[model samples]
Target: MAVSQTADTEELMTCLRIQLYHPEPQNIFSSLPMDNRLKQEAEDPVRLGRAAEACPFVLNDTKVSRKQLALMAFRVPGSTEMRFHVQNLSRKGRLQVNGIELRHLVGAELPDKALIRFGRYEMLVLREPGDSETHFEVLFERRIVAPSQEMGEGEARTVPVMESEDVTLSWREPINEPSESDEYQNC
Candidate 1:
């Protein structure tokens, strides 16, 4: 029993960690319920795009068109190494890795901290849990998308800043007395 459990653990450790970032406000699917089959790579190569409902990670950005598939990721047949492939759906659609726009590159070996920008979305490719460098915190300034003073509605998106500070806020004095009338307290 222990040996089988260890094998399962090893298989999970070989999987790649993919993080999605976008210029638009997007929900982090870490808390979302993942398909058991997909988690085990039952589908082999997972399809990801606006139309891929079975995709473990789905992008819900406005800039992403729901016309065709955008990206594909899979593990090497018998190896633990993973590969990422991209498909340009639109004439103006593009994918960028680490700020380098890939025009002719169909597939490439995913490296640690590899930044992928597909359409208006940016994805961070990370190694599995074994890497110490993969553990870090990301801080976002604001939650909702605020109207930009310069741009029109829904034109601006908040960018998240990487912060090292563990303490988010400083301690404040505790309020002893209630702001409302004290008569209610006596009752």
Candidate 2:
């Protein structure tokens, strides 16, 4: 009887983790900050926004609303597979998942791997299997674009250009003689 109860408890367990992901740091000595990572249970919904009292995962950006979005976990009917869904709660901020936009109060099923964008933030969501629990990782990234520099009078101005790594050129030989079909058409 106790074994069956334990199995039931384990089957209901779900774990979720969120971390700030940096694709490539300009400095090699820089390391990932521990304060940016968070862990929570999937049974309860996770709220993200600028308010610390209402949301456990708080974003300090002013552009984020009080409750920007919520992540909810659900189990597939007739199957043990677990999946996650995201809902946009903010009326001012737009939510995007895998390039698909969600309006206010709109929700959508999250893919196994997805790129989510809200305001100036981007998150990579990944679903992975765990021992005795369903595990999910949300890698968060803040998109920051560098501003153009202004030059004073009599100073030279230069713009930065990015070079492409994949550049291909194809060359074909031209035919001097006309084909039989061209001769027939002419006649």
Scored by TM-score, the top model is: 2
Clashes by residue pair, model 1 = none
**Candidate 1, residues 58-135: lDDT per residue as tens digits?**
444445544323344444477544444444344446655444444432444444334555664545544443211212
User: Which ranges in model 2 have alpha carbons more than 4 Å from their true place?
Assistant: 1-39, 131-187
TM-score of 1: 0.45
Could you say which candidate leads in lDDT? 2
- TM per candidate: 0.45, 0.55
Q: Provide the global lDDT of candidate 1 against the true structure.
A: 0.39
lDDT of residue 131 for candidate 1: 18
Q: What is the C-alpha local distance difference test score of candidate 2?
A: 0.54
Q: What is the C-alpha RMSD of each candidate to the true structure, in Å?
A: 18.9, 15.2
TM-score of model 2 (CA atoms): 0.55
lDDT of 2 by residue, 3-22 (tens): 56555444433334343332
